[model samples]
Target: MYIRDKKTSFALVADKAELDYFHQVSVKDCASATVYSAYCKMTNDCPAWLQAAFWLRDKMSALANVENIKGFHNKKPDSPPKAGEKLDFFDVVEISEYELILMSSDRHLSVLIAINMQSNEGTSKNLTITASVKNKNFFGHLYMVPVRPAHSFIVNNMLKKVSFK
Candidate 1:
């Protein structure tokens, strides 16, 4: 549960005493993409398989009365989202030139997703995604049983689709 080599604002959430689950993934060599643009690519242009996975996830979550997250959109926004705006299912927590932090909370759990961009000597950029969860009840713990592994797989696929320029 610790992320090394990368300094991330995610540490704030990771340090929380109630942290129940945590995962981080990164993609390198994205020289031309900004934090907002990279996020748009990962979400707006989601592949068919990942879209289907979202569908399945929504259906399963509904059975347990968990909040249903909106599926990825095909239309990309012309501008970056602001703090008070909504980005898919998450509320925009903070958005800046090099970082975007989003969150969603419900009766079961609160989830925070942070996307951080690091410039490597001005030649290339690295994108790191960190997901932190805080389970509020038994259902939250149970929900993550399947979600933990699936989250890593899904994020890897999404990261691969992020267009550099």
Candidate 2:
């Protein structure tokens, strides 16, 4: 890790890859991180709401004249990401057997999302998902002012709804 910040109450340890991703990102405004978790088969059958998030994101992109050049926004995944694979709404920044890093950027802002799965002592697996955002310009910050809260709400709801059969 390039820089170490105090861990949150959740004690989320940013992995080297995560830190590297952030290190490479340059933001005029603050770079923010938020984490969400769920008890589910994380490597498979990702939550529908999570996919819905991208669908909503695509509409927003259209309004801003950001074309979905990779066509990933509309492609829901049935399996874990491969190293060179494009994911639903973002480019595959990096990936490993246990970690998946996805990123997207426009004139206004850049975002990185990481999803990781680790086995616990019991039946359910622990899924940690983190999102980091960097603003490219003033409008990015202004647009995110209210959207930040809503973003948290959406992530919380998506995580809460994720469950395995």
Candidate number achieving the greatest lDDT relative to the actual structure? 1
Model 2 Cα lDDT, one tens digit per residue, 1-165: 112235521112253344322322111111112111121222235457655655675577677776644332333454545655666556676665545566667788767666655555554455556666667777667657656766666555545444342
How does candidate 2 fare on TM-score? 0.56
Candidates' RMSD to native: 3.5, 9.5
* lDDT of candidates 1 onward, in order: 0.78, 0.49
Clash counts for all predictions: 0, 0
Q: Which lDDT tens digits does candidate 1 get at residues 97-163? A: 8888888888888888888888887578888898888888998898899889889988887787663
Q: What is the lDDT of candidate 1?
A: 0.78
RMSD of candidate 2 to the truth, in angstroms, is 9.5
Q: Name model 2 segments beyond 4 Å from true.
A: 1-64, 68-79
Residue 157, candidate 2: C-alpha displacement in angstroms: 1.6
